[model samples]
Target: MPFLRNAWYVAAWSSDVSQTEPLQRTLLGESIVLYRDSLGRPVALANRCPHRFAPMDGGRVRGDALECPYHGLRFDRTGRCVHNPHGDGRIPAAARVASYEVEERYGAVWIWMGEPERVAVTPLPAFDYLDPQENETSTGYLLTRANFQLSADNLLDLSHFQFLHPDTLGSNQMASGTMTFDEVGETVWSRRVCRGEQLQEFVANAYGVPPGMAVDRWLNVRWDVPGLMSIEVGVAPSGIPREFGRMSYSGHFLTPETETSTHYFFAFGLPKAMGEAARTLVEYAVDGLMTPFKEEDLPMLEAQQCALGDQDFWQARPVLLSIDGAAIRARRIMDRKIATEQLEQQARIEQCEAEQGGKTPMPELTAVPIDCSALAR
Candidate 1:
């Protein structure tokens, strides 16, 4: 569970947090409560109260601060204890929770679980296509009982779709499709093209393809660090240029809840130029196709997790196939990044201890940003 803490991870959708109540979610194994302040800006803080260790989510939002349900101590947006109804109303210096940096964009609230200083430089993975003003978008969340990497692998290597989702999103053409993998800086790209085949009924309808028509279908996926992916799927008449085809864009943002669970946020979008009919088609695909596909994927992922219980993924010695190239590359990249961060952190701690003449208190970690501008697709 050595997460790339310097990167941004989706905490909740914009619609999930409101000014009236706090939303509790666990990310990177830490309990975080999210709520909007008086001005309707999102706020994220450690969920545990400093006094009685009560969860802040159980308390009510009082303007820009959250009132502790246990003893009525109030914590402000900066996580400072501003109101103490106890004896003398004197707040202890330690009566504050850790506040995390958060940003609201592309209809999701992203949290930085790592060093605060790096937040300014580590820009969020570009997802401008998800802006509602430019495109018709629908989002959904699924809590999968599986490692975030496992869920990520599922998206990176889509060969499983032919077998795992034959009825909705797959076909024999998928296995025979031409696939390629490439890396441009920190981003990983996987592309597949199937020629002269009819897509699944719902998929064809979503792309405005006529029944029984043979088309060239393409699936292209781009992966950013720490499990952010954008997928483009399109279909064109056999011999036509892909630019003239019907296409849809989707995003998959994975945030680990723990070593064995992940918070999956996904969105499907179509250009507003496609009109209301395309919007309705996207909604239908979400409800009719994606919903059922989730039903199929979750159980399989959970079963895989149960099988690998307590054992590391590499320690389990999974057999790799040609289809696994993209997934394996992504795993190696993430592993290297996490290892580097850990080493830098240890060095800083050692330097601090040496300067203090003993093992004194450790100072805040200052992380160097990992530039992912090349990963923006």
Candidate 2:
């Protein structure tokens, strides 16, 4: 999969790579070792040593360097082989291990898996209101074990919440309501209006919502790409009549853990869950509700992958209503990008062959500097 073309994927949270520990995560089938250096900056490196393939994560962070567990190979933040304990301090050009583009934003750390040279860390995603440093935010991560798109579909499929989270997070109202879509360049924002009791109360809590409100505010705007979202939810007070009120926004991120799995990151807090305190009381309740919803999703998505996995080329199933204009647009965009990337690769190979007058080995892609911050804008 050409996931690197223009997609943004989260590597780890800022809290993940503590100064005391090295975190290991696999992306696009590559194992990476991430850790904070002496200055508390996150760094990434391929989790292997060039000599005998020792797993680097087994090593410890000593001073500003990460030393390999096996051969005592030491690499700096840029993945430069700084010292070979066995061969004095001489560093060779071939001694360098592949490193990824790394950046910190919105209290999380991101590492690109594609050509590190082409990764741009400039455009990190935007959060609506819940500031990581200020709000009573809670953090959690899940390994989907399914295609990232399946998880995206799960998030985009809010209709399931009604039957899935009936007592807590579900909206009996949206059982039968309308869904709307607004396309933003390279990104899509979607909303579902489940007009009913709980939903009405939620709407009333809209920013500066009136004292006695009765309506269903747009609850979510799924950032239908691979960007993280910051959502602020305004819940109507408990005493408000069912006929009045609404829920504003709750933030989320759908990150691809692999082509087949995703990491669903979330934070819910401050006045949440009716009479009970949200940050304190609702945490467990929210987890309980989300746990089932997530579990219920596995079979459906896994089956989706199985149905299509064995093929050499991906096939598109017939589109339906919920797939909507945004999903359709996203697929089209992805297809175009994928095709362009392949064509570009082929062109490069053909050009290289022509230059050699015939059949010389084509050079691999050179890593381009990435501006990771651009996706947010």
Candidate 3:
């Protein structure tokens, strides 16, 4: 299974792609363009025109078809050129480009690069809060130099927040909480309510919680298909979930560019009663402080990814802790999925061979999703 080839990966925010036509993006290194069709369904296609090899994203949208800017060749969402200005009477049936399946959810556009026939939108992780009326949320997108896996690893761990994002969302006490992990329904949920004396002091100063009130900082990691992690964090009194202020924080990793570079999509939700004042404050803090903190993490991951080769690449465990279990389990699950996908691919090859009799040929493969073993070591 391709790490991101089959899953519903967000390409862009809804507002960014609604204007003119197909929006182009590089997920897992293949350039794809996304657009809404006549039936108002979103679809993706290989961004290049096979004829002259021009980018289809540069083309204009003419009704349902996206017209190539170079030759005025128009191809529909299925990547078929219905109208060719230079053609005699009819366009050749062979003149077409690769089209992909796309779906829009949670204010983002998702594309499928694997077998479009096998893509199922039902099992996709849906953000239910986006549908409800009581949530006040905003989406933020950023490109990072760190490996996607590093970011995934970072998000699953709440222990690093004290050092990484200390000023905004971290407390020295919560960083050393007794975390518990449980796996259910293809997802790993882990959480710990902070109780350290330092954390209690920080909470008292920040939120005016009583000195006796212990904060339950719950963090849930829903690993939707292997590498894609949906993280939710909430802070409430030791036993109460209702006092949760920041209700949700979800982050997703797009297919990597050069293995070390990644695009991160984030959806943060707070109570609507928090008002515009709170929203503006959050935005300002995230942009000014959080972004720079993320930038600080970039060099660490980049150096780690770079040191993998030419040195001892996965021959030893450098250093680890109990807190790494969340990331460890996440990797184990991904490894299993990748192995299953490889087995299925092999089975299909054998089946095709049995049909035609004799030598079996490997089918065309798209992106290489994730190499799970690398994370284990």
Give the top-scoring candidate (TM-score): 1
* lDDT comparing candidate 1 with the true structure: 0.87
Candidate 2 lDDT, 217-294, residue by residue in tens: 344555644545543333443455434543333556666666776676665544432334446433553465465646
Could you tell me the lDDT of residue 264 within candidate 2? Answer: 67
Instruction: Rate residue 350 of model 2 by lDDT.
Output: 65
Candidate 2 TM-score over all chains jointly:
0.79
The candidate scoring highest on lDDT is 1
Candidate 1 regions exceeding 4 Å error are 359-377
Q: RMSD, each candidate, Å?
A: 5.6, 6.6, 6.1
lDDT of 1 by residue, 4-110 (tens): 88999999999999999899999998899999999999999999999889999999999999998998999998899999997899989989998989999988999
lDDT against the true structure, per candidate, is 0.87, 0.61, 0.65
Distance from true position, residue 75, model 1, in Å? Answer: 0.9
Candidate number with the higher TM-score (1 or 3): 1
- Candidate 2 has an lDDT of 0.61
Which candidate order results from sorting by lDDT in descending order?
1, 3, 2
